[model samples]
Target: MRSYSSYVLIAVATLLVTCHALHKCPGIPGIPGLPGRDGLKGQIHLPGLLGPPGSLIGRPGRHGLPWLQGLPDSLDTERHDVLVNLKHRLSRLEGVLALNGKIREVGDKILASNGREVDFASALQSCEEAGGTIATPKNEEENKAILGIVKQYNRYAYLGIKEGQTSGQFMYINGTPLNYTKWHQYEPNGKGMEKCVEMYTDGSWNDKKCNVNRLTICEF
Candidate 1:
């Protein structure tokens, strides 16, 4: 038969051993449990039923105020005036250009094709479009065109026909048969053996050569 206190002491020692066995020795700690349903979360608030969505808002807001002011009348008037002036100048230039052929000349100076400006290239192209060939002193049309370009503009230099070129002979412009000629130092001996012709300021042709450098005539 055991004594009651001895039995109690033995039970306590056994309980301690059982608790130690349940937990591993030098054990690794467990991950904490899932946070527990969040406890219904966030204030448990219910928005007061939204108050029926706000009434139509004061009669559609009254139209908006006519946008912006249109431009003033004076601005329109000035723009129209500028356009008219431009048109007048353009017309006057065209009239003068027409006169140069009878007033006979080379056309423009600055050989744009050589250092050819775009405008001159276009003019050359335009003439080609019109069934006209590029004008040279020898060609009758070139002699005329030169006069027009010269009289209209001042900043150009019109190169003259060389002193002794005669016409009716095969002159060369890129190897094309430019037989046209003008005589500068001589007069019209009925388009003389002077096959090479140079242009005169009064709008006429004379015989001359390719080498002469006179102020050239150009159409701008």
Candidate 2:
């Protein structure tokens, strides 16, 4: 009971001191405080979150083919793995290196047709896909055979050699009569300049500046 009374006395003493200090507080005439500078403008950016920038093709409408969902703006947010994978697929596009060191681009259909050494059948199909035509000449007499072949497929075409500079030594395309260049002095004669052009079956070319009227292997 005595401890409780002592605590009450201490609390009364603290209140008395606070009251005395408030009473003694003077009427201080106010001095002006420094005015705060106006707050800086917030960033002047647009309010709403923005979408990805338009592509060169712009955003595609819904025709129901492959469509790009908008890409992420942040570089860190983009899926780099997908782009890497697409690049890899592009590099692996199926194609064949021709005997002439030219490229014969093809699709999966070409790979399916199996043949000995090379796949001419599949290559022909690929050529058609590429808007080119094909032909087969049995012998030297069949140089005109390409006309029928071209008429059958695209109006324009290129002849593929069965062997390098061996089978008939030439072929034809549309109608323009091209050939392996077999050039010599004063060739394709009978006139002042009736030059004859020739091509080996191996894609090699020659021209004769004389009157020897050799058959041509044309490409339109």
lDDT, candidate 2, 6-60, per-residue tens = 6556644544465456653222333444557865544322222112233323354
| Runs off by more than 4 Å, candidate 1 | 1-142, 152-170, 179-197, 209-212, 218-220
Query: Per-residue lDDT for 201 in model 2?
Result: 40
| Candidate 2 Cα misplacement greater than 4 A, ranges | 1-71, 74-79, 95-199, 206-220
Give each model a TM-score: 0.25, 0.21
**How much lDDT does candidate 1 score?**
0.42
The best candidate in terms of lDDT: 1
Local accuracy by lDDT, each model: 0.42, 0.35
TM-score of 1: 0.25
| Per-residue lDDT of 52 in model 1 | 16
Top-TM-score structure, candidate number: 1
Query: Residue 114 in candidate 1 has what lDDT?
Result: 22
